[model samples]
Target: MRRSPWSTLVVLAIAQFMVVLDVTIVNVALPRMQTDLGFAPDDLQWVISAYTLIFGGFLLLGGRSADLVGRRRIFVAGLVVFALSSLAAGVATSPLELILFRGVQGLGGAMLSASALTLLMVTFEHGRRRTIALGVWGGLAGLGGTMGAIVGGVLVDNLSWRWVFLVNVPIGIVVIAATFFIIRESRAIISGRRTFDVAGAVLSTTGLLAIMLGVIRAEPLGWGSIEVIGLLAGGVLLLAAFVLVESRSAAPLIPLRLFRTRSLSLSVVALGLNSAGFLAMFFLTAIFLQQVRGLSAFDTGLAFLPMGIAAIVGAVVASRFVTMFGTRAVQVVAAVISVIGLLLLSTADASSPYASSLLPGLILFGLGITAMGVPAQVAAQSKVRTDDAGAASGVLNAGYQVGGALGLAVITTLATAHITDAMTGGTAPLAAAVGGFQFGLLIAAIFAAVNIVIALLSPSVTVDSATATEAAELEPVAI
Candidate 1:
């Protein structure tokens, strides 16, 4: 199959958007889901965590599968799974059923998202075209969370919470049908010498799941609690075992040599740190708006609309910035901007007006994140070999998912402890919540500042007109 590059991008971007949107779409609808399904308060968290854990755990395996089998095949398979699971979730009669379906949705998302990026990489050459494509891709990635909230709100308000899941069914079907005609298949040239590293995959996936479990549970259980400590320790040991297994495997799930590329490694680190701060910002701000500012779900979603718009604008401009200033410089500037935004947000309180205090910070953070995210992705993918494209993409995405999980856990814990202290000191509930959110914002600012340092340390890599034209001339893969 052959298709116009733009059409191919549209297909892939839509798929990516659907997968990413699910991450946060259910958040606003949680209370409704709980009431309908009779969920216990503690068990409600699983509705979100189930998707996240499975997505994070299987990302590497999904990426590697794309490399070994085929991108188009994995992408289509993922769509089928995602759509079916989404349908199941929509009609779920019990909390356990919804959670299980959501886990399946996450698994499908991992396969789809991992291959989607790899497909984009293969379809576009590594220069201007790729940069522009990635900017769009990264912009969508940034927009997904905000959009999810918005879409979830409208659906939940106008129809029902189940609409959020049902919506994916139609979109998935359209995408799957279009994909077969529009996208071509591509995979690494397999060799008989290579074998699947089942042991490595098992260890890495289980290790990551355990780590995320520990992190998520830490919010409910104290960080110093025995269960938390044990889960964390076990996770670390399993990951270590994964590394050892990969070192000895004939076909490792992730090539350790990929990390030897300083740009890729540093970019991955920056991506993780950036995601940690960015996602924590979203988590805290959403809570602040609803719990403290007394905004309804619909209003809260509207509040974030500007952030989504700003992110799209920033993403559109990022390619040009990368062309002119290089990835390292853009990353540094973006980090600085994000830090300022976080700091601005830290000053917000119960009395702060939305326009004066909240909006400005949201805009700045949105702009900074899109600018940083696109270029960081480009930098990481720039030097990777075609054979390792899926694996590399998986590693990058894993950094994002894991970082968000870990960051949310740590920041939430810190904020909760602060809230506890304030309450013990006789602070009002709402005031304490606001104070705790402010503290979390401050910590998030620190994280962004660290990203600035990391970005500054990264080696410079720029795109020029010559490279752009050269890349455009290269032939895309054909099935």
Candidate 2:
């Protein structure tokens, strides 16, 4: 069943937008949620960490399930789970209840996100059309991250913090309905003896969960804590077991052979590194805006708007350049731009105005990250077979999720340590905080700089062969 590719993209993008939006939307609402739910100061982190850990942990399973079950089926099921969980979260009377619901929401998010990307890949044939569609997808994703703060602020200020979760209800319903009509059900066509790798799934899921748990707790517990060390070691051991299982299984959960694809392998590596820095940048920036600058939630969110706009523009520019030049060149250049952005950001201080110090760096970083991201995404998906779309998508998304969790954990610790030392050395509170942020941004800059080498390792591929004829031959979609 052939559906209009653009229409398919719209539905998929909307679903993915919700997934990404939830990652940061609650950030601005944390204060209100803490007050209303009577959450302890330390426990508040669970509100965010729960969602991230579950989402990151089960992504591989959710993605592979889409292939074994059905992409459209999993997508619709995810929406149902996500919507119900959102409603539950909105009305929760206690912190524990809200945290549990958020974890469920993350599970649904993993299901939707992986399948949506898979369906998009199968719907749009690999060519200029797919690249353009991916560009749009990447732009909307970046927009969602930026818009989360804005939307969360407005909802929290005008309505209530509950609206942050409640907002997804109507949007989820509409998208769920639209998805059935727009997306055709698709799944991997297995040859024979369809065997599910149960051991692989269990090991990988538990392993990821353990690692994410360790990372999330590291900030409060300290990285040197016995619990953190145990969790990290256990996760590594489980993942090692998973690798062994995959190598022996006839129908592996994640085919070890897929990593043999240079483009996909390199793309995932670069993305993981890029995401580490990107998430750290946002985390630090938000803290600086709210803590040091003493901006209201709404005002802090507004400060991020320019970066979002720059991200959209970057996606468009990257798509064009990939068509004209190639993936490797665009990725290399984008990495360089991101490094410059981070460097600029490091220069900001307590007295520095937003317009003069922060805005330029935000815009440049946003543009560079999104631009580099689109090509890497396209290249990764392009190199994989249709049967492995869900697996590949899952791996890609997991890289991003885990990278963010790990990055925020390490980066925030470094920043906090710096601030603690500065204060001990007789630095003022404001100056110490400012110095901490600068140091964090510098570390993030180093992460971005590493991407240049990673990008250089990409296989050069151009989408120009069908550019002229394909553009002329494309049909206009009312959607």
- What lDDT tens digits, residue by residue, belong to model 1 across residues 1-479? 45688789999999988887887677667767877899864455567666766777678888778878898999999999999999999999999999899989988998898789879988998777887887677566656766888888888888999998999999999999999989999997876764657687678767876776676577668789999899999999999999998888777777899999887898778877777786678767876777678777677778888877877666656656778888888888889888898998889898878999999999998888777876787777678898676567677767766666566656766777788789999999988988999998998888888888888888777876444222222101000
C-alpha local distance difference test of each model? 0.78, 0.78
lDDT of 2 by residue, 270-380 (tens): 777777777778767776787788777788789888887787677667767878888889899999999999999999887788888999999998789877776787677
Query: What RMSD does each model have against the real structure?
Result: 4.6, 4.7
Cα TM-score of candidate 1: 0.85
Clash pairs, candidate 2, are none
Clashing pairs in 1: none
Window of ten residues with lowest summed lDDT in model 2? 470-479
Error of 2 at 93 (Å): 5.2
Off by over 4 Å in 2: 1-11, 31-46, 92-98, 120-142, 177-187, 195-199, 212-225, 378-390, 421-429, 465-479
Task: For each of the candidates, give the backbone clash count.
Answer: 0, 0
